[model samples]
Every structure is written in C-alpha cells, then in structure tokens.
Target: MHLLAHRGYHAKLPENTLTAFASAVEVGFEGIETDVRVSADNEPVLFHDRVAPNGVAVAALTRKQLSEVCGYTVPTLTEALDALPGIWWNIEIKTPAAASLALPILSDYDSSHRLLVTSFRHDVVLAAAEMLASDCGLLNAHRPAALSTLLHAALPHPNLRTLVWDCEIVDPDILRQANALGFRNAVYGAKTLYEHQLMQELGVHTLITDYPQYVGLLPG
Candidate 1:
C-alpha cells in the first residue's frame, strides 16, 4: 500500500500551494493529490475553494491578478507538472470547465505513467476519459454503498483501477467488495494508527490523510 499526501500535506503548510507540494516531496511521499479549477481567464489553477482566503471568488480574478492578490500565484497544469517532476499526481478536476482545460494539458504533458486524473463528478470523469483516452488512468470517488451496487457500477469500466471512499464508508465488507472488483480502494480521513492498520490489513492501496508520517510509511 502507498501513503498519499492529501492536498499536499495541508497540516504542514497551506493546502494546494506550491510550498505545500514541495514539502510533500521533501518528506518522500510518492504521490500527492490536489484540486484544480480554471480561473476567469481560462488558466488552470491549483486551489480547492471557489472562494479565496479574502472572501474573493476565484472566478472574479484573472490568473495573473489572482496571484497578485492571493500571495500565491495560480499555477497552471503545465506549471505543476514542471514543478513536481518525476512524482505521481492525483489531479482532481473540480468542475466541467476544469475537466475540459485539464485534458489537453494532460495530453500535452503525456506522462501517463506519472499522473492519474480523477473527479467526483461523473460527467467530468467521462469527459476526461473521452479526451485523455488511454493515456491516463481515471479514478472515481464514490460514496459507500451496498456491495451489489458497487459491483454493478464498477463492472462496466475495465480501465478504472482506483476508487476513493469516504472514511465513514469503510468497513471490512466494503473493502473486500472493492478488492474483488480489482480496485485499489482507499479510505480518507484516517486519523489514528489503528485505522491505518485496519486499512493496511484490508489491502487498501493508499491512505489519504493529513498526517502521512503518522501512518508509518517510513521505517522506524
């Protein structure tokens, strides 16, 4: 199983900032997940919230203007790929526009071995798959449901290899069902050592957590 830094280890620095991403690399995390949104000028930027820290909506500012006002510049998809070379990325498209913007950039980057495009929105996932085709893997974030329902929903997508479930949805049965479906399922919000052990025992491929270090990825 792998330990993935959530929003670039936000507990240690500002979430989705380049600084935070760099810190995750420094700590030797193999993968990092971050949210992407398009600015008013149509440049893709790494930011989770529609509203900025100052209560200004991100859509209200151009990418360049957003950088001047927000202290951190809005980074393009290209910029992020350049900044974090040689690391696997889980880039979540936050909206349809972002999905559209990301597909081309991802293709241009064309590092299918190093990037997985994911989205909570089903439409975004479909669009990304259509655009990216076989170049990148698609990860689906789904709420926990009955084993039968999960099996039904997942059976059609042969290319879908990763699933992220809410922390509340994790149970032995669910984990078993996901494993049966050939998915590398992960539970979010793992706050304790016991939870980490439970996930590891269940064969979860990754743990999305604020404290990646506490999950005991590094040798004692």
Candidate 2:
C-alpha cells in the first residue's frame, strides 16, 4: 500500500507549508496530499479552508495578503512543487476556479506519473480529465448509491482510475467490487489501529492519513 501524508505530515508543523512538505519527505513518505485554492491575484496557493477564521474568503486576498493574515507564507502551487521535487503529489483542487488556475501550472511540470489531481466536486475531475496530463480522481465522502453505479459513470474517462472514499464507508465488498472494476481504492480518515488493520486486510491501494508515522508502523 502507498501511504500519502495528508497535508504534508502536518502533525508537527503548519499544513500545506514548505516546512510541512519537507517534513513528510524527511520522514520518507512516498507522497503527500494537499489542497489548492486560488487567491485574489489569481495565484494558486496551498490552503485548506474557503474562509479564514477572521471570516475573510481566501479568494478575496492576494497571496501576500494571505501570508500576512495567516502569519505564514502561503506557498503557491508552483513553489511547493519546485521546493519538493521527485515526490508523488495528490493535489486536491478545492474550488472550480482552483482547477483552472492550478492545472496550467501542473501541465508545465513533469506530472504523468508523479501527480494525481482529485476533488470532491466531480465536475472539476470531469473537466480536469479532458485537459490534465496527470491522473484524476473523484473524492467521495460517503457511500454512493451503488459502487457499480459510481464506476460505470467514472470508467468512461480512462484517466479517472482512483476512487477516494472516506474510510467510514469502506467495506470488503465495496473494495472488492471497486478493484474488480479496475479502480484503485484510496481512503482517508482511518485513524485508529483497528481501522488501519481493516484497511490493510481489505487491500487498499492508497491510504491518505494525517498520522503517517503511526500508520507507517502498522503491518500492512
């Protein structure tokens, strides 16, 4: 199983920052997952929330303004990739505008094997599959109406090979069905030892976890 550090191994550092990403690499994780949002000046920055704690929208601030407000540098998508090369990246486009802003930057890089762009918004994944050089995935938070139904709708796009489900919704049958349909099973929110054990037995392809160090020690 491939273990991806969620938010760049942020257990000890600020998430989506260069420091956090470097920390993930330092600890030897193969890949890191991060979120992308477009700032007011049209720069694609690494941030998770749509609104700041101060009730300001991330899109309403420039990259510099965001850094100042957050008290840390909000690295651009380009900056993050440039700073950490040769590591696999799971870039989650947080907004439709972010997909447009981030895809061009991703295209300029060597992305075919090293990048996977995903989103909860299926529309973003649909649009990205047409234009992106990297692989695309759909992130679902709950169990769909039917696993086959989801695969049938997604299989038309050849690049959409991964089904990122929340761990709460995963079961052996669902994982088995998804695998039979040629989809890679990836999940997040597997926090406990039992959950990790369950994921291992189910043979998940990827585990996007916040506690990479803890999960890395588990028998897979």
Candidate 3:
C-alpha cells in the first residue's frame, strides 16, 4: 500500500499546514490528503473544520485574519498544490462551495493535481466530477456506507474513481467489490501497527495516517 500522510505529518506539527506537508514530502510519502473549504472571498483554502481554533467560523475570516489567529499560514488550495508538487493528492472538499471554487484553480496545474477529489457530501463530489476531468470519489466514515455510495455512483458515472474509507471500518470484501466496479479505494486514520499490518494483508494500495514515519518503516 502507498502511504498518504493524513493532513500531513501532524504528530510534530499542526495538521494541514505547509510545514506538515513539507515534512511528509521529506519523509518520502507518495501521497498527501488534505481538506478544502471556500473562504468568504470565494477562494478555496485548506482547512479541516468549519470552526477555527478560537471558535470563529473559518468561513467568516479572510485569508489574512485566518493566518493571524491560527499563528501559522493555513495554505490555500493553490498554495498546497504548489507546495506538494509531484505527490498524489486526495483533496477532500468540505462543502459544496469548495467543490465549485476548487475546479478553476486545479485546472491550472500540470497533472490535474494527481488528485482524487473527495467529499462526504455526495452532491459536492458529483458536482466536482461534472466540472472537470475529475478523478473524484465519495468519502464515508465506514466501508459499508462507501459501498452503498459506490453502488449509486457507479451506476450513473464511469468516471468515479475512488472511495475514501475510515481504516477502522474497511475490510477485504469491500476492496474486492470496489475492484469489481472499476474504482480504487483508500483508507484513513489508522493509528496502530496492527491496523497497518491488516491493511497490507488485505492488499490496500493507499492508506492515510498521522504517523507516516512509522508506517513507512514497516515492511513494504
């Protein structure tokens, strides 16, 4: 399985920061997964939650104010894309506006970002696919939900590419079925060695985690 740093290497730095992403790159990760939302100015920015650390809505702040309060520059999607050149991305769209706002920015990239644009909101992911040569996927908290969603998405669109599953909830059957339907799958949030070992045994090709360092040290 290919290891994707979840929100970058946040064990030693803040999640989703450029510093974290750079650390992941330096550690030799093949992929990085991050979240995106549209700012008040209609620009796509990297942010995991709608609420900021100090209880302000992330949508309520401009990019400048966001940096000030957070004590670090939270990268815009444009910035994240530029910083993470040559790595595959599983960029999760946190809202519908982000799905729309991100497409134009992504189009300027050389590789369509080597991206699998994903979202918990089905409409948002579908909308992204409608807008570009989208390698898009639906995100679910578990494998069963993702399988159900895949059944829906696969029936209508052959372009659908991946399902981002919580590592705790994934199993061999889901991967088998996903392969049968012509989509790849990725898993996230595995924090233990056993989980990583299980994922490898199941033949997972992509995994997301907070500690890419330990996972990368495992038998490949």
Candidate 4:
C-alpha cells in the first residue's frame, strides 16, 4: 500500500506547514496529504481549519496575517509544491472558493509530478477533474447508499480514478467493489497496527496516516 503522510508527519511538528512537509520527506515518505484554503487575498495556502485560533475565518485574513495569527509561517500552495516537487501530493480542497483559486495555481505546476487532488466536495472534484491533468478523487466519510452508482457516475471522468474513503467505512468488500468499477481505493483515519494490517489485507491502494514511522515499518 502507498503511505501518505497525513498533514505531513505532524506528530511533533505543526501540521500543514513547510517544516512538517520537509520532515515527512526526511522520513522517506514519497506522498503527503494536506488541506488547501484560499486567503482573503485569493491566494491558495496550506491550512486545514475553517477558522484560525484567533476566532477569525481563514478567508478573512491575508496569507501573511494568517501566519501571524497561527504563530507559524503558513505556506502558500505554490510555496509548498515548489519546495517539495518530488513527492506525490494529495491536495484536499477545503472549500469551493478555494478550488477556484487553487486550480489555476495547480494548472501551472509541473505535470510530471504526481498529484491526487481530492475533496469532500464532489462538485469541487468534478470541477478539478475537468480542468487539471492530475488525478482527482472524491473523498467521502460515510458510505453512500448506491455505491456502484456513485462509482459509475465518477468513472466517466478519466482523471477521477480514485476514491478516498474514511477507514471506518472501508472493508474488503468495499475495496473489491471499487476495484471492479475501475476505482483505486485510498483510505484515511487509520491510526493503529491492526488497522494497517487490515488495509494491507484489503488491498488498499493508498493509506493516509498520521504515524508514518510505525506504518512504514510494516511489511509491504
């Protein structure tokens, strides 16, 4: 299974920052997952929360102000990708407006670098699939009632080849169905050794985890 450092191995370092991303690389992770939100200046920056610690919306602050508010430098999406060009990125767009801003930046990126642009917003995923050369994935926490129908609907988009599901809802049958429908299954929220073993047994394509050090030690 491919292991992606969720929020860039932030067990010690602050998450969604350049330092964390570099640390993820230092530990030999080729993939990193991070969230994207647009600042008030319309710049796509790497940040996870809807609101800052100072009780302000992320969209209400400029990138520089966000860094000050958060007490650490908040790297713009471009800054993060430019600094770490080799690693595969799982860019989770946090809002539809963020998608509008981030897509243009992502379009200018080197196409040779692998990217799996995903979002809980299906609309954003569809929009990204149409515009980007990179692979786009639909992220879902809860299982949809018509799983096959959801797969069939997404299969038409050539770039939409993966489904990022919450590990709580993933099982062998889920993987089998996703595989049968031409979807590679990626799961997040797995935090234990048993869960890691279960993902390997399920034949998951990717495992987004918080503890890469431990997960990486598991036999591939």
Instruction: Quantify all predictions' global Cα lDDT against the true fold.
Output: 0.72, 0.86, 0.79, 0.88
Q: Estimate the Cα RMSD of every predicted model relative to the unseen true structure.
A: 2.7, 1.5, 2.0, 1.2
Top TM-score hit = 4
lDDT (tens digit, per residue) of candidate 2 on 175-205: 8888888889899999887787778778999
Candidate that scores best on lDDT = 4
Q: Give per-residue CA lDDT, model 1, range 130-180, as digits (tens).
A: 665432233435554565654454355555556776666567776777677
Estimate the overall C-alpha local distance difference test score of candidate 2: 0.86
Model 3 misplaced stretches (Cα beyond 4 Å): 110-112, 143-149
Worst 10 residues of 2 by lDDT: 211-220
Q: How far is candidate 4 from the true structure (C-alpha RMSD, Å)?
A: 1.2
In angstroms, how far off is 26's CA in candidate 3? 0.6
Candidate 3 lDDT trough over 10 residues, lowest sum: 142-151
Per-residue CA lDDT of model 3 for 1-220, tens digit only, reads: 8888889988879888889998888887888889998776766889898998889988988877787888888789988888767788878889877877776776676355687778899787777777657577878785565566456754566566777788877778888888787778778878788888888788776888887657656786
Rank order (by lDDT, best first): 4, 2, 3, 1
Model 2 TM-score relative to the real fold: 0.94
**83-167 in candidate 4: lDDT tens per residue?**
9998899999999999988888888883867899999998899989899889999999898777876676577799899999899
Q: State how far residue 138 of model 1 sits from its true place (Å).
A: 7.6
